[model samples]
Target: QFCVNYKNGGISYRSARDGFGFELDWTEFYTTTRKPSAGEVGALPVSGGVINGNLGIGTPNILGGSSIVLGDNDTGLKQNGDGLLDIYANGVQVFRFQNDTLESKKSINVTGRLTPTDYGNFDSRYVQDIRLGSLQYGQVWNGPGFSDTSGYVITGIINGNSDELIDGAHRRPIQKLIGNQWYNVVSI
Candidate 1:
């Protein structure tokens, strides 16, 4: 007969099979491996030990954090396999690593002013947008003013198919800023 004294956090336990009996309380849960004092939580310290599979925090529900960190200024943290690490502040993803390389998948979307002291590098998918009064580089890509129905589209010529120059009226698709690389722009 296993009786639980839930009022005072105690348990009355007995084995019905062999007439053998033993009482196990919440703290007694770890008494077999290590004796824990009254009102103390159990902790296991295993250094240089191997964890086989995925380790999870708040597996199903959301795990909250204030001042969360993955790799700090000091010695960094290491994650080997393809596991996702999400860092959230105020319930928003400030930094995330999902893909293979950390540098490739890592992204920072902060609100306030961010000033980097050292030189920073970005992926090749980034382009500079220069602006002058009513006109700007990459601004013409807006096609017609964006609404819920239509927006700008970037494309490259394929085989000898449909014309690639914004419906092919003004064939001047390539625009060069002085000696820089040509920018394929769509006209208004």
Candidate 2:
């Protein structure tokens, strides 16, 4: 068991693998064989914030199941071909990272408190539409858009009518409303 000194003087229960990028207070960590049952394994806030439990940063599998594990071919967090971050809490995703960046530029190096509604969730087809929700949780991108123009690039609302345009553009909705809440998600 690895320990993290979370912001707000809060300590975290996770693994040493989660401590890769950030510094950790080794003394506060609770030594145990039990892996993190939820959230990123080592993505604690800087020094004084609460650890918002998310499945994206450290741990991959859902909690509660004894056999939860990182999927096959997975090397690190968000390394899956799905190409999106999965933020799960206690086995359920409370949020996700949907990148609208083009395949040529995959990482989101944006500044400030960026919200999912800011980007179109990696689908260039909807990039031009400012009126649409930028990103929704739970969705994933297979890869960059296909090389062929005949193959369409998708964004929010994978299988639905365009909200603003009168002409129906037939494409998959990259975003979907889960439990009536809009989240920038990449469906795997």
Best model per TM-score? 1
User: How close is each model in CA RMSD to the real structure?
Assistant: 20.7, 28.9
Scored by CA lDDT, what does every candidate get?
0.38, 0.39
Q: Residue 18, candidate 2: how far off, in angstroms? A: 42
State every prediction's TM-score relative to the real structure.
0.22, 0.16
Question: lDDT by residue for model 2 over 1-188, one digit each (tens)?
Answer: 54444444445553344446764444443345433433345544455445333342245544422222344222223322365554333443444455763332233466888657544445443333222343323222332423323323334334235455332222433344543344443434
In terms of lDDT, the poorest run of 10 residues in model 1 is: 131-140
Which portions of model 2 miss their true places by more than 4 Å? Answer: 1-81, 101-188
* TM-score of predicted structure 2: 0.16
Candidate 1 colliding pairs: none
Candidate 1 accuracy as TM-score: 0.22
